[model samples]
Target chain A: MEALLAISIGVLVAAAVYLMLARHVLRFIFGLVLISNAANLTIFTAGRLTEGMPPLIELGQVAPDPGVANALPQALVLTAIVIGFGLFAFALILMFRAYTTLGTLDSDEMRIAEPREDDA
Target chain B: MSWLLTIPLVLPFLTAVAAFLTRESDWGRKVSVIGNVVFLGAAVLLFSHVYDKGVIAGQMGGWPAPFGITLVADYLSAVMVVITAITALAVSVYALSDINTRKEYLGYHALFNILIGGVTGAFITGDLFNLYVWFEVMLISSFGLLVLGGSKAQIDGGVKYVTINLVSTILFLSGVGLLYGMTGTLNLADLALTVPALENQGLVTVVAMMFMVAFGVKAAVFPLFFWLPASYHTPAFSVSAVFAGLLTKVGVYALIRMFTLVFDQDIGFTHTVLLWVAALTMVTGVLGAAAQNDMRKILSFHIVSQIGYMIMGLALYTPLALVGAVFYLVHHIVVKANLFLIAGVAERIAGSTDLGKIGGMYKTAPFLGILFLIPAFSLAGFPPLSGFWAKYVLVAAALEDQAWIIAGVALLVGLLTIYSMTKIWAEAFWKAHPEGTDPTLATLTAAERRNLLLPIGGMAVLTLIIGFFPQPFVSFAETASMQLLDPSPYIETVLGEAAQ
Candidate 1:
């Protein structure tokens, strides 16, 4: 199962990298989303997968029983997902604005900030 | 005890909320300036406590360290927080005149405060994941501030800045996951103890490289720095000044922390990589500046150049070298931020930041020229200025280590830095204004002049103070470097007696 998950992560990352290499800002955002999900999967897998074991303590117990799933990585991944979602949303809006204001989604054509110099 | 550290982190959020609520009124900018003053006071308290007590660590909500979020400050973190507060205060005041009412209504002050809060949190976090969160906080707010005006150039620049930084953020998050997978611990103090004991030291080195690339982008070193020059000049001058001063330093601070504390197992390989990156960052950055005709763009590229020196000091891994790095960090913040503020002033009065389009400041505004000279010369590493001492220490440390090429690179970069500063001096200040305008400081109102020049003057005084009185600051950085080299005190404070 761990091997399978790792292989999936690799594929996701490879695809993400390919998409991110594109000049279209929207494609780059989609690539960011994919790569970030891959990262989330990594954290989840690294926590050591466990089945039928919730990280919950029973009544009159101070701690969960042995073999309980590690909850820390889940918490970290949840946080990452939320932060990544917010960033993706912002990036989407920024790309839309770039399309409208700059009139093109191609990063190469966006040269108003750093104009191409004639001397160089 | 925890509250002492929490105040600096939380006050900025409180201020941000208040500033947002007041954004419709004239009170927004006023609240920002006042809030920063209070934040500075809290930071000073934190610094004083850390100075007297050595490393200080506190767990949030009274939870034990390694099990809960840890906020810790040694000498290095303490001084960074203090300097961050100083820069925030200066920029907030500068914003009073520089930021327009339309921007104020757009919640500029709120974003600025949140960015400060994020920087402070990054400086103080003792958990790796916590640092990642703070980086996000800083990144998001900076994105807003970068494109706040929604101009075409700002949008173009913001897209690149946002995209590139997002990649770095993902890399950092993955590095955190991988390192945690290897060690089963995320608390920095615990990792410092566990990383060296792992049998898979080879894997640890690979993870170390992951973090190096993650933070390399943040620190704007070598190949990863293109985003900075692309976007920094497009922001509001106040935003650019704060970004110039505090943002990249956060990356440098993170690198220093992770490398010194947790990733020290195989320094030979890692530090050598850093050494080469340092050399190239310096050379390419200064050469990039030479090609720029815009005042802000030249300064922007120079930022990448100066970061090389700091990284050079860290790469050396000697006590004195780290001291040089720390000294350079503090000095660069003040000098670089002040130069940006002065650029803003020149743009305001002279009508352009393009050096070719604007000039004659030396004759009409001698006072402003003097103000610019203090930071400009200091940035070029002139004697008795802050940059000189910083460069001197790093070069001396390199020579002491018998690394002649790196030392030569350091000195050559300093010389090239002088050329760039002189180019600005010659074109923007010394030469006649291309359009034949006088461009006097009298062009601004009394209040505008006071709001603008006060921060520039205050920071100039700070640069001079550090330059003239290097002894105390050097000793402080020495002790900070010592704490970094041996984080045992930091560990003991965070994880308590059993960790020893």
Candidate 2:
């Protein structure tokens, strides 16, 4: 299970990197989203996968050493996911505005904003 | 005592919400002023308490470390918090009249306050994940503030700035994830303990490199710095000044903290890379500054060059070098912010930031010229100024390590730094304005002059105070450096001895 999760994360990271290298502005935003999700999975896998374990609490009942899952990584990942969502929304809006104003989504075409010698 | 940490972080956020709600009233301005004053008092109180009682840690939601978020304030964090508070107060006051001219002044203030809270939080937070969250807070607010005035130039600059930072955030988050996977912990103190025992040294190096790249992008080091010169000069004076002073330093601070604590074992791998990068950053940054003719653009490029000095101290990794990095960080924050504020005043009087279009300002605004001169000289590492002491310690450290090449590069960078400052002085101050220049440009209104002078005076006085009384600041930096070097005290305090 751990191996599978790790491999999945690796693939996700590769896909995210590929998306990031694209020139389209929207693709760049999607790349960020994919990268963050891949990161979340990586953090989750770091805790060493365990099965049949409930959320880190113990109840009064007979159970076979109810090896609870690691709660710390879960908490951290949860916070990161929320923050990543906020970043995604921000990027989406910014890209939309860029598209409307620049009349193109190509990152290369955005070079008009580059510093010109005459600008100084 | 730990509760004092909440004041700097919470007040600005509360003020921001209040400002947004009361967006149309003078009451918003009053609230901002009151909030900043309270924040200044809190910072002073926090500094005193930390001086008496070492580092302070606060666990949020009543849960101890490993479960809840922790805010830790040591000498380093406290000093930075104090700087943030004082600088924010001065900039806020200056923005009172300056920001009102724009349609989105209230929104700008909201974003500005949030950015301050984020920077202060980043300095104080002990949790690694929490640090990233605070960075996003700073980044998002800065994005809004950078484009607040809504000019075509601003929107253009904002696009590049926002995209690059977003990419950096992704890289940083990915690094954090990989690190958590390897160590099964998110707390920095916990990582400090666990990272050393990890088996795969190669993976640790990779993670460390990722952090370097992410922070390098923010710190504007070498190859990753192109976005800064491209964008920093497009914003309004107040926005550009604060960003110029504080934003890049946060990145340098992260690099210092991580390299000292988490990646200490990867020294052979990472330190060498850092040394080469620092040298390249300095040379290239100076060359970029030399090519710029605009006052702000020149200063903006100089920021990247100065960051090389701070990174050099870190790469040297001596106690003295760490102290120098801390001192340089403080001095650069004040001097750089003051220079940008001077640029604002110059632009106000001359109607342009371009050096060719701006001349003879010293004839009319002599105080402004004097204000610009102090920091420019200090930034060039002139004697009897704060920058000189910082460079002296850093150079001494490099010599102690027998890193002569790095030392020579640093001295050469200092010379180039002086040249750039002289160019600004001669072009903007000593040279005569051309005939037929607008007469109105020569006159400064009473309110405008006050707005310009107040912040510059505040920073100039700070530069002088730190220069004259270097012992206390040096002692504070020494203590902070000690905390960073042996983070055993930090880890034990946060996680208790049992966890370790």
- Per-model DockQ against the true two-chain complex: 0.90, 0.52
In Å, residue B73's CA in model 1 sits off its true spot by 0.6
Q: What digit string (tens of lDDT, one per residue) describes model 1 on residues B1-500? A: 88889999999999999999999998899999999999999999999999998998889988898989999999999999999999999999999999999889899999999999999999999999999999999999999999998999899999999999999999999999999998899999999999999998999999899899989999999999999999999999999999999999999999999999999979999999999999999999999999999999999999999999999999999999999999999999999999999999999989999998999999999999999999999999999999999999999999999999999999999999999999999988999998888999998999999999999999999999999999999999999999999899999999999978
Candidate 1 ranges beyond 4 A from true positions:
none
Instruction: State which candidate has the highest DockQ.
Output: 1
Q: Per-residue lDDT of B411-446 in model 2, one digit per residue for the tens?
A: 999999999999998988878876436423237677
The candidate that achieves the highest lDDT relative to the unseen native structure: 1
Candidate 1 at A119: error in angstroms?
9.6
Taking the candidates one at a time, how many backbone clashes does each contain?
0, 0
Q: What is the lDDT of residue B142 in candidate 1?
A: 97
Tell me each candidate's i-RMS in Å.
Answer: 0.5, 2.0
Docking class of 1: high
lDDT of each: 0.95, 0.84
